[model samples]
Target: MTHFRNDMENHDFFDTNIVCSIVIYEWANELSIIDFKHIFDWISQLVGTAPDSIQLAESEAKYKSYKWKYFEKNNVINRREWDLIAYHWFRNIETKSGIRVYCVASTRSFRRLGIYIDEAAVVDVIGVMKQISRTIIEKVEPIYGYGAMQSYLDGPLEYARGINVTTYYSHENIFSQADVDTRERISAFGSEFRKNKRRLNEKLRDVEVINYISAGHLAGIVDGMTLEDWIISGNRGTLNKEGEATWVWRIPDEHERSQIRTDLIRSGLLVVTI
Candidate 1:
């Protein structure tokens, strides 16, 4: 692992231990159409909310229907108005006493950018996409750290695992396990397989080679291989025909360029450049 100095300025960070609720509102809008009933049913099962017990106020229902029709007629809504409403709702719940609430949704409608939801609530307004056939409650569980009280509306929101660069790899591991099981359990869950494959490919692309050695040895082996001032300048034929220079990367000849390249391949690192 590579370590870097901390260069962050002091700032107020949110409490990571607090219990938070997440609400994913799929409200009908001018941009995208979704199946409200299906989403409601899926969330209900996840949250342990009785399907029949969830209340849909009459006025809210009417407004939803009107907005649905309006969206159908017009391609999109007034962006400013929609943003204002979303902001107001988030502010209303975020400042509530005793508990922290987070608004998370895939849709860009929500104004809280890059804020991970402590809880997700799918409002009755947003309809579900038609292509979705099954709900994967387990996938959502690990996203919020496992053992969170899973619920649709009004369920106790459990804190999700803090998402950092290191945890990103962990998340991929969990997702890979889920994909393997999903392929065995459901015949049509090929989507999960494709998604995992794509992620694996992306991770392979980020692999890099780091060379650490004594400043003196690196200078003797190759120019510009060590710290700037420590580098030796001379006609050293350290580069290959492709103009790719070789650096003394602290590995013995047995683990040098050719051998290391092979090792990296086995370790799932695609060497795009020497």
Candidate 2:
């Protein structure tokens, strides 16, 4: 069985030409939410422009709260510090160089900062990851961290023709305490996966791996992989002073992608039910 997303043509579908990088973090509850200014500012500098639109989530409580709406950039940026009490901020900022950047900041349990750029900008996703290590990980010391380049629409066709590159980053032992914490979480996830009665083969049925292959030619980078194999791949990982550790491969196409999706689901890092 294979899976396919029928809504790929929807408005919210990722733009094929857009390149995105995502940083995953265990929420920093101890840090002040106000630090969002510094984070967004860093993103603005990277894109070389102020944000055009902003969305905020101030109250955790759903009652009497409507802060998820998009607010004018000027209205939010021009306000005083005391007024910027939102727990989450999302921005859409673009540059004249034909680069589009989208940044999201949050102080919630699982914090993720996503950076989306136009392929034309040719921004270094790893550079962005290194900056995140210095500015966020060093100070906040998150329990676990991972960064990866995402697959966009038309990924199979684009990569089959040598259009884009796919990258993965998983950290181990960057900080003593955080390393231990991340290991424990991964272990627990592994245990949970084994306990599930659903067969691993069956789980693969829900997601389609879009690929293009010709006679005697396979354009996929990953041949065959299991859940544990993917989890243990992080053990050999190491980060530099700037906290850089990445695994890069070209032509991930649909086969490798399907394996990745399966790994993420089995590890509980992502969720989808058929």
Candidate 3:
């Protein structure tokens, strides 16, 4: 399979592929506790209500709801330092014409922000938030001192994703086109990535393929064996053994098995082979 390969010269074969992406960020703006308080107060004042009191009003023809709350839990802001949050709210605005702007404060970086355009919206939420955050930061940046504004997809490391916006600093999708067979194999592997590892002692006399999921867990068979030997042997067979497993991954050869195993091991998503 494409994911598994043999290096002829090295006479080696490895299974699977794991990909990781990370971005780091530095301080862009600064804000003190008092400044954050003021910002929250300003936003609440603009809407003519207290943070918790913000909600849709029947009087306004347009649908609207603005809410916020403060928490003193341990959190990483700006630089990996723990600090309390002053203002936080997930906001969605839609015009009568169907234009929408969705925005949320960066939970990672207390002072950072994020905006993603809704699929149906005509206007870019990023463009709108950029202008609004710029003004807010301009007024608060010098006063409060916070990290720079970095845009990131919805996930962890939004702060790291914010470190810089240049192509070099931004997240890049490295996925490439795979042939039909390769695509199918990858699809199968990904779908079952969280399944427990299957036991095929026949392929690995001493070692047993294992499952991995999130953060850690990937050592390839109980005992380390030469890639060549592992390839020559395999773990696939006719459906003979059965119990609670809903399904099993019918590995073709140890070479391909090792590749898939390697990929799963690297990404930390191997489930018991099933």
Q: Pick the candidate with the highest TM-score.
A: 2
Residue-level lDDT of model 2, residues 175-268, one tens digit each, is 1122343334334434433354323221221222211111111111222544234324643222222322212122225565555555555544
- Every model's Cα RMSD, please? 21.5, 16.2, 21.1
Per-residue lDDT of candidate 1, residues 1-274 (tens digit)? 1111122111212222222222222111222212333343344343333221111122212222123334335533332222211110121223422122222223232211111122222221112211111131211211111112222221232112111111112211331122332223222212332233322212121111222122222233212232223222322213211101212222223334345444344543321222
List candidate 1 segments past 4 Å from native: 1-14, 18-41, 44-103, 107-134, 137-274
TM-score of 1: 0.21
Candidate rank order under TM-score: 2, 3, 1
After the best TM-score superposition of candidate 2, give how far the Cα of residue 147 lies from its true spot, in angstroms: 1.2
Off by over 4 Å in 2: 1-14, 27-29, 59-99, 109-111, 121-129, 154-274
Report the number of backbone clashes for model 1. Answer: 21
The best candidate in terms of lDDT: 2
